[model samples]
Target chain A: MSSGLALISIFVLAVFVGFEVVSKVSSTLHTPLMSGANAIHGVILVGAIIVASHSDNTLQLTLSLLAIVLATINMVGGFVVTDRMLEMFKVKKKPASSDTSGEVK
Target chain B: MSRDLYDLIGLVAAICFILALKGLSHPKTARRGNLIGAAGATIATLVVFFYGDQLPLKNLPLILGAIVVGLVIGVPAARKVQLTQMPQLVALFNGVGGGAAALVAIVEYLKLGEEAAEKAGAIGAAVLIATIFTVVVGTTSFTGSIVTFLKLQELMTTRPVIFPGGRFVIAGNLVAILVCSGWVYSAADTTSVMVLMGLSALFGILFVLPVGGADVPIVISLLNAFTGLTVAASGYVLEATLLIVAGTLVGASGTILTRLMAEAMGRSLFGTLFGAFTATATAAGTADTRPVKSGSAEDVAILLNYARRVVIVPGFGLAVAQAQHTVRELADLLTAKGIDVAYGIHPVAGRMPGHMNVLLAEANVPYDQLVEMDEINPTFPQTDVSIVIGANDVVNPAAKTTPGCPIYGMPILDVQQSGNIIFLKRSMRPGFAGIENELLYDPKTTLLFGDAKASLTKVVSALKSL
Candidate 1:
């Protein structure tokens, strides 16, 4: 099979998998879901890195460097913000909520 | 690193991305899910660093410098931004991804000259198509996301900016993008490709400028999907497995979210994109002249103190007033009196999807106490008192009763059906959709006018006095 066809197959299957995975996320988690997905696209940074590393000219180097910057921002910012938001939903273990045997709930 | 080793690493990263999404389905595992996704990114970056193709050692400082600058800007912005501004921040972050993808494709295209293109032969077809696709979609998402961020940030008018020939201008720009894409595809002209990128960016601005703020969330989600598609195109250019898998996943999920948000607003995808809610808001503002019964915070407190079951309906106003913590205090006080207090969260209650949930969660509101519109609507009839805080559109009765209303078919919280409703509002203004709420005029509803925070504070003090 052609590599193009192989890529298409991977793309189609990934689409299905994507839909199925996030379909059950409760509405309460939708914001985090979005930011999480936003971060996933940050994988584009790898592409940026490849192009930048192989750049042969000053112009190409500059453009590729810009890509690196923007992609880095997207990757770092998206993940950190999502983690912060999700942390608010976490149930902190406290002594006041401990069981009679000193085991925390 | 060998090709086989890099592929294996990419596969592991892809698996991590999938696990991350799966884990986010429940709040219990969401924090770990985020961390897992980040770990995947770190691993992917590391593998690329060790890949056989040597990026010149001299350029190492430049690459690291660029990343340091990105960290400086991105980290502080994410940490300092208020939760109320989270939607706009998300839009801005999504834009940077698209910008990066577009730049990557552009750099790759520049590396391919006429002789190189000739040597590439049939594979040149794939390269050209991917490069052109990435340029068009990525640039569009980049500029479009900026416009959405501006509208949401209130830097620009949230109302749709309509002109006499606005649709024509947008249509004309889209055609330009198409013509440019065709020229670059067939001729392989480098200049035409850049022109196509410029036109797409212009079209993006025109595309989002006319969309009202209420619709920005859907637009952001759509742009996010566009960014994902662009990344996938970039992946093809780079031949990286993780990028392909991760980008397609993001693209699909973002599309679903866009659809869900549009459905919540009772709009089709196209309609939400072109039809501004401001047009409806203006029409409804003038029609409702009926007097509403106004009450003091003490009066609302009295009704609440006597009630057995109290339901709270919060909207964007609650977020705007930064009153989630105060509202939680009132709920806590009510719970202390043995009153069964619960929250009704409309699906599109805040600026972004699940925005109200995050805001209230930050205030320590128990997840169980917060209920979806479908689940909580049924219990409203049994509710003795329903307090609406800075909410207008989500609880509006016109959605069901007035066929002529723009939001007539939209689903809303059944706050009007409760035994009594005390509305907390700044004025007699309509909601974001600009429709007059029949619920406000209902005898069972009492309007309490003030800043949401101040009014809630007074009510809390009043309950204390009792």
Candidate 2:
């Protein structure tokens, strides 16, 4: 197969994988899940870096640099915020289980 | 690094992303999953630098400085942002990501210049089309996310902004965007591309304008998908397999999530966007002086103290009033009194789907007590007093009873089914959808008009007195 065809195959498979992964998520996790996925696309940082390194002129360099900054924010901030949100869920787990335990007993 | 090594690392990062999404689906593994994704992102970023031949290390210092600046700005904002404001913050992050994708595409397009047209075949056309897709969709996502941010942040009106011939105006803008995209495809000129970007930005703003407050999260999710597809297109343009995989994953997942959220709200995606056009203008400003049985906090306290079962239905108002902690205190007090208390959480309770859960969880409200709509709806009929704090739209009976209203057909918490209902509201004003809830005036309902926090505080003190 040609290189383009290989890329197309990869793209199609990835789409299916993406849909399959998050298909069964419960409603409560929707916010953090969306935020987490939002951060994943922050991998655009790699694209930004490539464009920045390829820049030959001042304007090109400026734009690419700006892209890098934005992409970094998306990636770094997205993960951190998602982690923060998930942390709330983490802390509540033990206490929540204990609270329910009393009733179970 | 060898090309083979770089590609292998990219593949690893792609797998990590898939794992991250899978891990995020459940509460037990969510934080660890996010951490794994972060580690993958860190690895991918670090490896890009070592891939020597393709990446000339010329702009290394500048790029490092930019990344540091991004870290400085991004980390603190993520860390410091209140949970209540998280929806807008997510919108902001999504916007900047879209902006970055668009900029990368523009830079690549500039670098290609006339050489792009020299490649005389289908590959050339494909690359050009990908570049155009990245530019248009990325720009639209960037601006659309910003509009949603403004609406959520209350920097602008959250109501649907429709005007005379608004639909025609939006349709014309879309047509103009398509024409410009075609123009850029034919000419590959910078001017046409620039015009296309501007039109796409305008189209984004106009597209999001007609969507009401309750529907903004869906729009955000859709724009998020748009950004993802743009990244995928840029990845194709840049010949980077990692981008293609990651971007397509988010695009596909975001699309599905958007659909799920729309379903939870009982809205078709089509009706949410274009329903404004078909909707007849309801007379909004006529002050309804209809007598609601207004009671003091003491009266509400007496009602709650005697109830055997109570369900708290919270909305965006609860978040706005910063009353989650106070409400939790009240719930705990009622539990002390042997009243069975459970929170009835609407899926689209706050600005985003599952927003209320995040807000409530921050206040350390137990997860088991936070019941989903379907599980909790059946129990509302058996509950005694349902305390609605700072929430309006999610519990509005009009969602089920009134056709042609903005929230018509949306699933609401069956709060009206409770034996008695007490609303702690700021005023008699309508909900975020701009529709007055008929349930507020029903005889079974009692209104305590004040700030949710203050009203709850009074009720707590009154319950103490009892």
Candidate 3:
């Protein structure tokens, strides 16, 4: 019961933290922010691994392995694609700076 | 490693996730933030191998192989997907994650087996309920995301799919799902659980089918939250603190984003999800075939060449025609002629929020020139020409003028206030919302009919020659 209460406290605090962190995001980064959050939840890969390690039967093992593969894709693909999107934002910034510097010269 | 050490590492990974989300909120810190998240994920995954003695060394090879296969598939797809297709790709990734959570819960349930039924007292019941919630919600998120993906990818009709009695049918499906969920709770039987999963999957498809294309982003955000809650539930069932924190965080954040997106589109969350049921079905193909003022690419070039100020309104169609580069070329030519130009980006411009910014960024458009809706709205009145590239709904005057219409209350780009409105269009088709744009027929508006890319290219050449 004490552990459950601890878990509940964690859940409540996390919710508050989640809202607080993303509440001020400008609309310009909405898509990347979303994609990044999507990747973070892919930490369910840990849950998948825990289950897979404990499976005693063929069916259980197969299911756990499948979960691992899917979770991996969610975590990995999500981060990579988010990075790709953010990369474009980064590349454009450099040229704008250079053009400003050129103007100064 | 000691159990305490593993948990400490997990907590670190969770903090990294919090930082990642915080970092993503700002453009300057976003890339680094994502890197931090990736690093945290790497830490969590590596620590799992050394945590306790639960993982048999024999199963290690299979686990590694599965992860390798996932990497082989996930990395290349992420790397190679077109910017235009990013929304659907994100939806697909989210769907697979939901499926994985469901599978993990199911495997855990199977492992618990009949023994779980005996301990149907408080804690065991809680675990069983959490497991059931994970299965139902995770499956719904998985299937619902796939439907959203199909809509965005244009593999399925982007319009709302409403049958004669869709509301009733959807309601019936929901009731059936609840009933099945109850059965699973009482019996704790494998068949009951499977039935609940199947019902939830059906409910997911039915739930999303009524949502129109414009509202698909909201649906995606909602499903992401659903997946997050499922992960949280599965965490409870498995007693993993990391999953609980990460999942609850995502669930909370995703809910906020969904609300923000819906608000941006001037839509209520409830209305977006269930508007099809309450509204009367307006007839399709009632397009007023009024003769619009069509102009040539040369004429558009002359107008743009002479204009002192221009604002380019971009939409989903710009991305569809892959005209970002061509449009940028036109803008550059206009800028060279001493005409000030800026892109007016609607919040929900493309398939997703900020999608147009990404597409435009890919074409190397200066960030300063990409003005947001609120910041750009007042400038439209003073602008000489507003070139709407393959966009319809965002600039449509009907949003402000016509009440009791689908998009009446939605805030729009006031391109109508410009000296001249020029639309680059392929045809007279209504936009994704299936509503006629009255601004297209305004006397001051000139239509250039062709693929946006081709039309922009012609305009560029014409302006250069002049």
Candidate 4:
């Protein structure tokens, strides 16, 4: 609830937004964007951890705890799902027998 | 003086995210990227529950309720959704992101009323503005994206499904936006905020509904961008640094993807906007579309080996059979015969964009052998052969000559030029684009009915034996 904390949050968020807009024009990093952003989820985790540690107020602590949990899930689960999806791209060698056809003999 | 190990956990998660992203650039390393991201997210969330104080004591039930409800719906949906419908699924997920952003903003705003802006310390006017911006865009992305999913899945019409006085509905949205914007400037309270939120949701729905089904790819991409922006805005409100950074990346990348898809379709952004959503099927007098032509594997196989330039246009059929390796084998044999071989890739070929590319790349087809639709279409006519392995829409002559057809004006593969054409399809079923391929009946087109991989390998054998 402190004005100081609120200001820091807004400034931090704004800078990130600015970074995002700039990155939009730079198309070189298309595939890795999600991965990069996933790391930022860690920042939320850190903030929540800090808040939990700072606030004796049960309500604040609980919320921060929840935020950390959700953020971690998103970061971890998102990466897992995305990885599996990408694996679909890997051409698996078919059973040398059936998954393929023969050269005209 | 406080030892917050939670911060350390968060920092660790962040590092994972970075590694995950770097790993996702190529198929070979993408799994690593995915794993790192998941690890980061998991750690982040666990730390939140263990440390954060945002969830009120009495409202524990609310959070619990949402998790329960979300699991019920999300789990089943994930289980049942097919790979062919994965694009729509992605749209649906993007919608969830928007919904989450809006909800987060709404909850935060509710807290603001209780905390009084003056007492809430640094919650400045800019924060309020950013929060509202995110809510509005997020709400819009949510509704618009769901509608997009419906359209793509054929649960709704693919065309501009305008109603009586549809233009009036749009004008009214403008009025609602003005009213909401006015309230945000005045009362700035939760009641006014709620009304504004309603209007924002309405505006989002209005913006997307009129977009024709033909533009779903771009629309989906745009909605994804909007969700990113919304999350970024929410990050602003929450003062969550990493949230903002992650959200912005999604926004930027999604925007570029939208622009790229738009360009590939030969439509200006404005051109797509002006077109009414139209899902009207284009099947008609074509009841007489040339009688289906059939071919035996041995007969067709002989023609393939003798041909000079051969373009293999892959489709969803290949994926259904999981036949990437077989395709590669066929291509290898042809290449060895000194035949020019290339894979013609349509932008929207297969169920989702880039699917054929993923499948072919898995088969280890040389990167140089993979050609895009634009690069390959022109060469089709001069080619000695075109083996359409599960492709339909892109090669559909209807895109070129048939007006009023569902896929009219869409670009197609110029396979008509090949001296010999072989179409391998399971049946006469139309492609996802919902238009019959006139290419099926071309005198030059010989239809080989079977699993695509089987037909292709059969042809390969004929070529090698001769």
Q: Give TM-scores for every candidate, taking all chains together and pairing residue i with residue i.
A: 0.92, 0.96, 0.96, 0.72
Worst 10 residues of 3 chain A by lDDT: A96-105
Rank candidates by DockQ, best first: 2, 3, 1, 4
Tens digits of lDDT, candidate 4, B1-466:
1125764664575456445544554545666666666666656655555544443433444444534454455445544544455566666666665666665665666555556765855446777777778678877877887788888777876656667667678888878877786676455566777787788777777777777665776787777777767766676676655466556656655666567666656566765765553334336324454587789888786777777777888877776776678888888887777677788887767644565665566567765666777777767666877888777777788878877665567677788877888888888877655566767777888889999878777877776778
CA error at residue B96 for candidate 1, angstroms: 1.0
Which lDDT tens digits does candidate 1 get at residues A2-63? 87788878889999988888776666677788888898898888888788787878988999
Tell me the tens digit of each residue's lDDT in model 3 across B8-116: 9989999999999899989899999999999999998888888757544448888899999899999999999999999999999999999999999988887776455
**Tens digit of per-residue lDDT, candidate 2, span B1-466:** 7889899999999889989989998888898889888988898898888876654577999999999999999999999998889988999999999999999998888778745567643337778889988998999889999999999998998899999988888889988988887888787667888898898898889888889999988888888888888899899999899999999999999999888888889999999989888889754445777888989999999999998889999988898899999999999999898788899899988888888888998888987788888888888778889999878889988788778888889998999889999998998888888888888779999999988998899999999999
A80: Cα error in model 2, Å = 0.8
In candidate 2, position B81 carries an lDDT of 96
- Each candidate's interface RMSD: 4.7, 2.3, 3.3, 7.1
Query: Which segments of candidate 3 are over 4 A away from where they belong?
Result: A92-105, B54-58, B117-123, B283-285
The sequence of per-residue lDDT tens digits that candidate 1 reaches over residues B1-466 is 7899889999889999998888876888888988899999999987787775563433777888888888898889888889888888889999999999999998888777544677875437887888999999999999999999988887887767778777788888988888888888776656887898899899889989877666788889899988998898788777776788999989988888777777777767877776652344344556766788999988999999998889899998999999999999999899788788889999888887688988898888877677788888888888999999988878887778776565666788988788999999988877766666778889998988989999999999999999
What ranges in model 4 sit over 4 Å off? A1-77, A88-105, B1-31, B46-82, B117-124, B184-199, B212-214, B277-302, B305-309, B317-342, B360-383, B397-412, B425-431, B434-438, B448-466
Error of 1 at B298 (Å): 1.8
B195 in model 3: Cα distance from truth in Å?
Answer: 0.9
